[model samples]
Target: MYRTWMRFLTPGPAHHRLGLVCLGVGLQHGALPTVGPRTLDHHVAVVISAGTGWYATPDGRRTPVTAPALLWLTPGVPHHYAPDPETGWDEAFVDFTGPATAPYTELGYIEPDRPVVPLTEAAAPRGVVARIARAARRDNPLLEVETAAAVHELLVTLRRARADLAPDGDPVLKALAHDACTPMTVADHAAKHGMTPAELRTAVRRGAGCSPKDYLLGIRLGRAKELLATTELPVAAVARRVGYDDPAYFSRLFTRRTGMPPVRFRAQQARAVPGGYGDRVPDPDDPPMIAGPRRP
Candidate 1:
């Protein structure tokens, strides 16, 4: 028999987020009679690291889910599920959102009509249990600092590993990096990777799970977001700094990817900061703008 443990985490409003969890596995069970009135941001997720459980809707729809399962829940769908008290269960839960959630929801990674998304595996819980245990030992105040980091790690890992995922261009992925300071054209990039346009598209989609162009755009947008939060760069400069020559085009693309234009993204973020997100102080010695995302 395998053993799994769980440690529950209650994050306050400031810390509400989705990802890895400090919740160690608890007792194992086949079913449960009660569950939570828990409500998360827009995306609610749960990972069944150990034990057996079922997710139930308000309408009494019960579905059994086992260990090593991952669940992503849609927003505003009231539902509840838990381990069978007789058999017991352990799980880590969290909430997530942003523009990405909508696309993911459409993909059926979660139940569009319902609130919960589930992924399961027999072995996942055993490993996740070990991870949570170790994290708890190293960090006492769960959901304090280390717990958040662990949760993020778990979320990243789980999202990257599911379904019969494709290869996702090992080369194309390698080509596109977070650096948006400068970048090469797709044509040139394809040649450098020794691929034709069609072949390049196929390879990238296979390995990375998205088209090459979309993949590059994602990296750029992610980097842009980092700058918006951490730097004093003006939004226009930030757009060019991230490779878009036209700030307007950059804004459109940014909005499409992040669900907020660069300027508004910066504004909303600045408001979230304690003393405001600092100030936009342009560097006098800033370097010239580059064309695209950086390559490896």
Candidate 2:
């Protein structure tokens, strides 16, 4: 019968306005029966990590509760829930509120009508609850800030987990998008993820409608463009920064892809801004070359 509960008397004005605040956090194991066929003024998220039970609504509808599931209690909602007495469950919960809550509801992350959301895995949600509980235990100066941040993190974690479970979601695309800036060949990237080059290419094409090499090249060029437009870094330096050791080869590739040399592209962009490039001199020897039409 291990149980711990911590409540905040006042979360303060700062927490109230941040649009999200944690009012309390608790963990219960082998606890006694039902908590209310009544209503609450704030929201509470109960994560059931083990055991079985039932959650009932005001209209006599009873929903079965299982382990590794999220039971949401929305504000002012009439609800009653309890674990099986014979085999009591383990549960962790956090009460939270703020103006930011409405957006989450509208985004389908939280639903008032749907009280139970079965999680494929409970580790992340359990970890977040533990974090909130730990932060609440410490009577630190940044208690409100820390708790609010943790709550936001919890919401983000839930949303991401849901996204990962979505039928159309492709994690391979996400990995590529995040790691595109790294200097690695397509084969190397595939090998790192325990995927063959052909498999990686197929996944990338299906997810992003582009080959792996093309996707990586696009990322490199995009970064190069930003650097060229904003900084005074030399072409050779920009080339190295974008994983290209050969300045001449990089310049040719940039020209082929963008239809303009790096220097010309920079000058064109600089001239677009008012009072920009007024005293700057363009490199004179960098001639623009127009390729002939390709034969089919």
Write down the lDDT of every candidate, Cα atoms only.
Answer: 0.57, 0.80
Residue 244, candidate 1: Cα error in Å is 14
TM-score of 1: 0.42
lDDT of 1 by residue, 45-118 (tens): 56665667678766778878666566555566666777756676655554444444555444334444744434
Report the lDDT tens digits of candidate 2 across residue range 1-296. Answer: 54656566368886799989998888888854688988989889888889889998898888898887888899988999988878888888889999989987865567687888777667788899898877776667788888899998887666545422543447886677667767678998899889999999887764455688988889889888877887787999989988888999999999999999999999987433333223234568865344778999
Which pairs of residues have clashing backbones in candidate 2?
Answer: none
Where is model 2 more than 4 Å wrong at Cα? 162-296
Using lDDT, give the best candidate's number.
2
Off by over 4 Å in 1: 1-31, 36-44, 49-53, 58-68, 73-75, 82-129, 137-143, 166-212, 216-296
